[model samples]
Target chain A: MEIRIENLTKAYGDFKAIDNMNLTIADGDLVGLLGPSGCGKSTTLFMLAGLNKPTAGRIFFGEHEVTDIAPEDRGIGLVFQNYALYPHMTVEDNIMFPLINRKVPKNEARDRAYEMAKMVQLEGLMKRKPKALSGGQQQRVAIARALVKKPEVLLLDEPLSNLDAKLRVETREEIRRIQQEVKITTIFVTHDQEEAMSISDKIAVMEKGVLQQYEVPQKMYLNPGNLFVATFLGTPQINVFDAEVHDGKIYCAGNMLRSGCMVPDGSYKGGIRPESFNVTLLPSAPDAIRAEASHVRMTGRELQIRFNLGANEFRLLVHSDMQIGVGTPFYLTTREKQILLFGQDGKTVGKF
Target chain B: MNRKAGNVIANILKYGVLIIGALFTLMPFLWMILSAMKTNAEIRAIPPVFFPSKFSLENFTTAWKAAPFGRYLVNTLIVTVFNTIGVLITTILAAFAFARLNFPGKKVLLTLLLATMMIPSEMLLITNFITMTKLKWIDTYQAMIVPWLASVFYIYLLTQFFAQIPDALYLAAKVDKCRDFKYLIKIMIPINKGPITTITILNVISNWNSFVWPLLVTNSREMRVLSYGLVQFQTEEGSAYELIMAASCILVIPIMIMYLFLRKYIIEGVTQSGIKG
Candidate 1:
């Protein structure tokens, strides 16, 4: 089912947790709501699940407005962060609870529960309670319970956050595979960019209860809508510098980096991704700025070098085959397309 | 070797104090049982006999034939069983509402309910009695069972337990389309078996031993509970200490047996609620 969230807002007294957020999730598409803590990603997921009521909004599940509907009637399965399996119940009974609540016959419910357990690879453990299961197994049981009723939309709230690092990766892949097999329109909330980027067909980046950008993962990473999106998406973070765009020339720290700029003459913020910087052995190269390598550390296949350009310090990742040492001077240059300029208001301006 | 000797001495001292305390508490019950087994003359002997000369069931037969003790036991069991069931129902529903539901004036309503706990139940006895009289329910089982069906302390205790359950569980049930009452019966009550068992045992014991309410409400012999029946037996067998002791033993044995069977759950429930007995 496709979901349309129109002008959704949730307010707690004077504070708004979600502010007029509008989004449309395509049918059978696995989207991710990505943001830091308290950014309202979870709140949006709850509203979508109908567990929370919006202050002013209309939510539609394929042409039917369900803003006032209860969670159970909304035809969406929600998996909580802690996988709230009934501790007193066995895996089979936990999966069968929803079916039984719908008044399905006992035999049919048991069959369906067994089928779901088999799908989650829990058939052999059907008689064991939740406390006896490992964290990953408990997570699978929660998913099986949620999907046993075949809800049209599946909502997961930090589903893999409780697992260890290795288990988190494995479980996310399992979740993606299951979501694909079920062909359900799924939206999962996560604070981990890599997890979101790895699984989601589209990622919606949010900040302070407002939607920042909604695009495919690579597009949002490469061509961010604004400064926050640029800095929030990447690991090691994008390097930002205070610069001036004067008379069609870009100057950073009293040094001219580029000319023939098209942006209006004023102050702007310049961002350069760490991997975008090019290193040279030559003392002087055209459009190459001189930088002194201050710190060099090997990180597996890449060398993370901290270099100083004038008084500014920036980190760069390079192939470890290059022999670079501390205090060595090198020429640094980047392609024009790699440079991102943001106006004073933090929105991307004209062209790089 | 010196440290081991010191530890042994400390252990002896700890158990020594505990043994003395246990003996002090058990002395009265021991006396009652011993007195009940003795002949009348042995009970009144100069230095009252610590042990019976020859144990016999003579006093028990006499006590059993004196009045309708069997009838009183039956009445007590009926009132206790019905009262426990009623209290459990009322307490669970009220506690679940207080712990989870959000409604207008919820805080004020809870404050009012809790304020009733501070009013001293003795003050409400006369009012409750008058209400019973007006309902024409005096000298009936309803008078004894209905008035004590809901207890604020139990409700508060269970509300604490219910509140400790994660809200995610409730939301999960809601998403499954389980109604509130079904969730309570299937999930909340089952998950909180220890506390609920404690409440049931406590309620059963309290109902079994209830004296004042039964005394005030019941005027007929057929409607009297065990506690009142024991008092009546005492007055009728005045100066016959052996018969009185025998009747007391009969009343006390059931409670002791019940405690022996359920002591583990009692301790678990008390510690879980963080409340002293």
Candidate 2:
């Protein structure tokens, strides 16, 4: 089901934990609520799941007013980060809990629990209690329990945060596969940008309880709406430079950066992804950032050359075969399409 | 000072200390049991007898008949059962409210509950006795049960237990559309069975052995509990040491049985409360 959150707000005494926030999840879409800790991502998810009521505003699930609805009436499945499986019950019983509470027959609940167990790839562990299972298995059982009721929408709040590195990777892939197979209107909340970018069909970036940007994964990465979105959406984070515009050129750190396009007069900052830059002492092409190489390190397939320009250090990725030493000078040219320029207020000024 | 000798001495010291400590702790109970089975002369002997010279069931029979011991036992059972059940039900419900539900006066109410815990039971004894007397509850079961029900300590214990439960569990329950009361009974209560069970055993033991409050309120022989019954059994004509010991054994047996059955829960309850205290 499609979900609409309009001007939702939650306050603790005087502090607005979640300010006037708005978001809309299209039906059957896998959306990721991505943010750092306490940025209102989990709060938003909780409000949507009907766990925490918003102090103000409304929520709609496909034209149904769900703002004031009780959690059980919301028809949503929630997989908590801690799993929340009943410690005293066996896997089968924990998975069967929702169905039993809904007055489903015992035999039917057992059958559905077993079926969900198989779906989560937990076949032979039904008799084991949650405390008896390993972390990964317990997590799978928790997922199975949430899915057993066949909720219209599934909300996962940092479902992989508790797992170790190997398990986190494995479980996140499984979650993505399960979400795709079910095609439920799913919202995954996480602070890890990489996790969101890799799995979500669409991503909503939040900062300080405000919606920074919302778009498809590729659009959010390639055309960030602001500095926060740009910095939060990419790995090997995009490099930002404090620059000035003069005579159709961008001047930064005692260098005239070549750009085929002219930036506005007040555009004081520009962001460039590392992959956009080409490493050379003198580029045959124009519009390149000039700097002295201060450090170099080999990273398996590439050499990361750190350039020193004034007080700032910019990193450039180049082929490992290209030998570069410290104290060497280099010119780094970026593709016109990959540059994301921002103004004084951190909002996007222009992009080609 | 060789290794073998050092290890042997260490083992000896360990067992010696443990055995001595065990005997020291159990001496009183041992004395009571021995005295219960002894004649009055044996009980009053110059030095205490570890074992009785002449074993007799006479003191047990006398103690049983000297007062309505059977009726007191029944009264004690009724009061204990009602008090335990009342404490458990009220504590769980109120703890759940304080732990989870958000209402306008939640903080104020929780502070009040905690504040009530700080008032020692002795402080309320006079006021409670007055209240009971004016209400015409003296010699009534209500006097023994009502004033002691809804204990703030048990509520605080349960609140701590319920609060340890992850918020996510409640959220998951909510998403399943489980009613609030049903969720409390089905999910929250079941998950926290450890602490709740511990609290129940504790409440049972305390209520069963209750003396002061029951003594103050119950004026009739029929309403007396175990501790009060023990006191009332001793007459000024002559102290029946053998009969008192026999009665003490009777009182000790139920608590021993309760502890044996719920030993695991009792230990856990003690340790959990120890950390908090």
C-alpha lDDT of all candidate models, in order: 0.90, 0.84
Residue by residue across A70-147, what tens digits does model 2's lDDT show?
878788888898898878789988899899989999999999999988888999999988888888898889888888
- TM-scores, each model vs. reference: 0.92, 0.90
Q: What are the runs in model 1 whose C-alpha is more than 4 Å off?
A: A280-287, A293-298, A321-328, B1-28, B39-50, B236-241, B260-264
Q: What residue pairs are clashing in model 1?
A: none
Residue range B1-277, candidate 2, lDDT tens digits? 8999999999999999999999998988888888899987877888766799777888888888888878888998999899888998899999999898878998888888788878888989999999998999999999999998888888887888888888777777777667779889988887777788788887887887778899889887777888875775577787878888999888888888978888887787677666321
Q: Cα RMSDs of all predictions?
A: 2.7, 3.2
For each model, chain A TM-score? Answer: 0.96, 0.95
| Model 1 lDDT, full chain set | 0.90
Model 2: how far residue A53 lies from native, Å: 3.1
lDDT of 1 by residue, B1-277 (tens): 6999999999999999999999998999899998989888998899777999898988988887887898899999999999999999999999999998888998898899899999988988999999999999999999999999999999999998999999999999999999788999999999999999889988988988889999999999899888875565456446678887898888888888988899898898878877654
The DockQ values of the predictions, listed in order, are 0.79, 0.61
The DockQ-derived docking category for candidate 1 is medium
Q: Candidate 1, A290: how far from true, in Å?
A: 3.2
